[model samples]
Target: MAMDGKARSAKAALKRQAMKEVELRHTVRYGIKQMLGDLMHWNKISEMGEALQLLILNAVPESALLYRNADIPLMPAEMIRHHARQGIQDRLDDLAGQMFGASHKHVIELLILCAHDAGPEGSAKHLRIPRHEITINENVSRKLDQARIREELRMGRDD
Candidate 1:
């Protein structure tokens, strides 16, 4: 009888753990989806600050709600900005070989613009190019600043 009770208890514990894992996965998925939706909406309006705030809010449900209620500060804008820049930089590094006729400066600016225009997933696609023979200009660095500024302005982005 005691052995049977132990077996039952173990089964119950396993069931509880499984249920908790499923709940956690659901919460994370919901959070990510909510954040993505907010990002898309804010992108259209060009309200970067608000968009970042929404992202932070979605990332942490309880904290975000508390912040909304008590007016406590949530995530920092600089952290989000840094994350976005780092994401762009990593993508650029991965696609360094595929960028055609693009200088390092141009690549940096293009990455920022692409991140704003396409988000992280879309920016990944934009960075992918057909790998083939390409010419590297000897003066790649000479016009980098000019190209970067030009691309930034053309894409309606600053930085």
Candidate 2:
């Protein structure tokens, strides 16, 4: 019983220490300090202020851009989640990575990929073609012309 009490006290101490570290970390002037702490942890940012700035300056702006895209979100939840989870996970994955046990990953991916700007004809990074040569059917075209000329001459001769 004494050992259990000691372990419980140790765990409580550790939790308090963690909370203190978060509080001591560079906090943004923004009102959402706890959210900043979560963001810092998620993005591997050592300072909470930097994470807050990132959310405000970078993540929000990028989502606004996606808001205009009108092409990625197959369902309402995808767009909602992307806006909810403000981080790099969405940028890394078309489905914007899993969140809250949402099951629309595959559908969102399809919608993003099928968008006009996302495929090979647009923003695709790597593209491949089977043949490199650009050739016209000169020989066949020449033969067809010759046949037409001969027939025209034959008709003239008959006339």
Best prediction by lDDT: 1
Please provide, for model 1 over 1-159, each residue's C-alpha lDDT reduced to its tens digit, 9 standing for 90 to 100. 256888997896687565442111111111233343444554452444334333322232222222222221233321122123333334434444445444433333333333334565553333232356887676886588779989889888653
C-alpha lDDT of all candidate models, in order: 0.39, 0.37
- Per residue, candidate 2 scores C-alpha lDDT tens digits across 1-159 of 256888997896787565442222221222224333443444455753343333332222232234333433233231112222333334333333422232333322222222323333431211111245876698988999999999999999999
Question: Which ranges of candidate 2 are over 4 A from the true structure?
Answer: 1-135
The residue pairs that clash in candidate 1, if any, are none
TM-scores, one per candidate: 0.19, 0.21
Cα displacement (Å) at residue 7, model 1: 48
Model 2 clashes, total count? 0
Please identify model 1 stretches exceeding 4 Å from their true place: 1-41, 44-90, 101-104, 111-159
Error of 2 at 37 (Å): 41
**What lDDT is obtained when candidate 1 is compared to the true structure?**
0.39
